[model samples]
Target: MTLRHSLLLATASLIVSATVAMAQEPEVDCDNAQTQMDMNICAGRDYKTADNELNAVYKKALEAAKETDEGFKDMGEQYVGAVDALKRAQRSWIGYRDGQCELAGFEARGGSMEPLLVSSCLADLTRKRTAELKAFYEQEN
Candidate 1:
């Protein structure tokens, strides 16, 4: 009934609501995919998406840094390096994912559906990577 008590209750309610909203958000699980191929594919997708988001955020930050301080303009070079690294990692991951998935399909040292398995694996990897990047960017934003 008191003003102080009512304000305290309102603040607690807001905190609880915010916590629930965050907890209800979806999470990605590439490791637990139904098939090995699916897992790889999801991981690949997740990486690619993350790469894209990282690049976008870096670009925005570079621009903002430039505007805020002329001396900071050179920091864009750092962003460029980060972008390059992410891209390189993504490419290497693609190769590793496919190779691993194809190797998994070996029943008698080689299988007919190896290609399909590789594709699915790549997709699963990508999905998982994308989810990770989404989380990173979401935090930054």
Candidate 2:
């Protein structure tokens, strides 16, 4: 092969090796995150964990609501039953959470910290909601 062709091939191999190394980078240690990007990523991960927890609790709550609705099924179409009420409340809560987080992010609006602010707010609110849902059901047992 020509010298120029051989040099280009070697450079391509080096670039691919660097890409592979970056792709295999170690997971971030959230507790010791030092950079703004790492903190933002950690915050996002926290929110995801909280959200998953909330979803599990919400499913239980929804099932309870459905069971409650079975008892009130004869109340007629005019009356909103437990399932409907719970669904409405959950939808409203989601709207509130999103809006609140958007406002919280305004503290660092248009900056790199905005994502961290939003994600942190989301995680906090989601955890609180999960607790509330648990309390609501726990009261019955």
Candidate 3:
């Protein structure tokens, strides 16, 4: 290849390598996150963490419901419906929380701040859901 073509190929390779390195770097390291985009990505990950905790708590609650189903009729529910009620309530709560957070995100829709807004909302709601499920846990105890 010609010298000029060789230089251009090397330059392109360096740029691609740098881009990949930046993409792989942790956003939370060394005060490295200073941009709105980076903050949004971090916020999204935070929401995922909170959602994972909520999921674990939710599974426990559902399992508890299932285990207690036989006594639900004894408690005057007329049948084994504890698990069914818990499932329905959880489904409705998820829908309500997502719709509420989506409305909250509309304030920054189509903008760099949108993901941060949505993710903060999600984390907040998921934390609240976790608390609510924990209260149910208290009842089960």
Candidate 4:
């Protein structure tokens, strides 16, 4: 709940969001694919790559946060609250990603839905959770 920690969280989120968005861009050939399964698989691979990159960013953020004075000292219940909120946000995002992807593929034929579903879900969830995290930080500040 220090300004530094809040800023770090915000920066990390932005970095991860940007990285994932960039990594998940679909290939041109995917659009012209005849099979739904192919499209879905292709999309899934792209999303998986982005997800891995996002995990790396999260790990770096955790390390950066832990190096902070507040993170080291573990001061105040607000710090704990912030960590809890972040964990909850991550879990919720995973759920949203899986559910959205499943729904997108339900009526489709192939992997084509992967990129669309993941990108859409990630964008929506990231925006919503960023707002929540910002609010939490504001209240803590």
Candidate 5:
């Protein structure tokens, strides 16, 4: 009933919870993820890798778009330049990706596998988008 006792109980509960959590957590092996948590973690890592590559390629695409727009600068306000068009398309693509991934997660619904599904979808979509951006940049170059 005392505040001191309450604080002590809370602290003990926290410590116990932390210990249990640590015990339950497995060492993730992405190559052969067996547990749900490990699979989720691996899927997240895949998404991160794809996102990083997408970001790098996107920067290159932006730069290429800028270069391409240089010739159009003289056309004044009448033209929608390459950089502007690319930015607009990229923004739309991001929205589409997030929505599509969220929809993919619905297969798992409220289950533990939802995150893994969403992450895998994101990774796949991001890699595909990165390829598209790379191809656009190459074509423009």
Candidate 6:
């Protein structure tokens, strides 16, 4: 690649990673997000928070199922199936979320507002997934 192309690629990678990193950190002030860039940052941050909670809840649910399995001497197969199903479901959900958000961003594709649209869709989906995982964690209680 030409130097210019290489630099452009590197800059794009950095921008994407930085947006995700900003979302993962707890420093974005959504209320004061006055610019399109700031709004995108805040939306991404929200998605990251929700996604984190979903992971935590899923882990707990799996752990709890494993613990419960001890009560049944021959239920190892059942436990494995349940865990496998949850893992598969989560993978599918992630693919769906990403595709859905990418499509939503088409409304402003290549525009300054595209990131905000994509991030907002991601946050919405992540929150729903969080609730679903939380419910699963609580269901066995």
User: Number of the top candidate by lDDT?
Assistant: 5
lDDT of 6: 0.81
CA shift of 122, model 3, Å: 0.5
* Tens digits of per-residue lDDT for model 4, 1-141: 999999999999999999998877555576565665555555555555656656655555444444443563657655444444466667877787678656754554355565566554555554555555445444443
State each model's CA lDDT, in order.
Answer: 0.58, 0.91, 0.87, 0.59, 0.93, 0.81
TM-score of each: 0.39, 0.77, 0.74, 0.45, 0.80, 0.72
Q: Report model 2's TM-score to 2 decimal places.
A: 0.77
Preferred candidate (lDDT higher): 1 or 4: 4
Which candidate achieves the best TM-score against the true structure?
A: 5
Please, what's the RMSD in Å of model 1? 15.4
> Model 5 segments beyond 4 Å from truth?
1-27
Candidate 4's displacement at residue 106, Å, is: 3.2
Cα RMSD of all models vs. native, in order, equals 15.4, 5.2, 6.1, 17.7, 4.3, 6.2
- Score residue 134 of candidate 3 by CA lDDT: 86
In the range 71-101, model 2's lDDT, one tens digit per residue, is 6668875654777888899999999999999
Q: At residue 15, what lDDT does model 5 achieve?
A: 100
TM-score of candidate 1 on Cα atoms, chains taken together: 0.39
Error of 2 at 99 (Å): 0.5
Candidate 6 or 5, higher lDDT: 5
Residue ranges of candidate 1 with Cα displaced over 4 Å: 1-80, 108-116
Per-residue lDDT tens digits for candidate 5, residues 4-61, read 9999999999999999996674568899888898899899889999999999999999
Candidate 6 lDDT by residue in tens digits, 47-80? 7787787778888878756555555537655544
Query: Global CA lDDT of candidate 4, please?
Result: 0.59
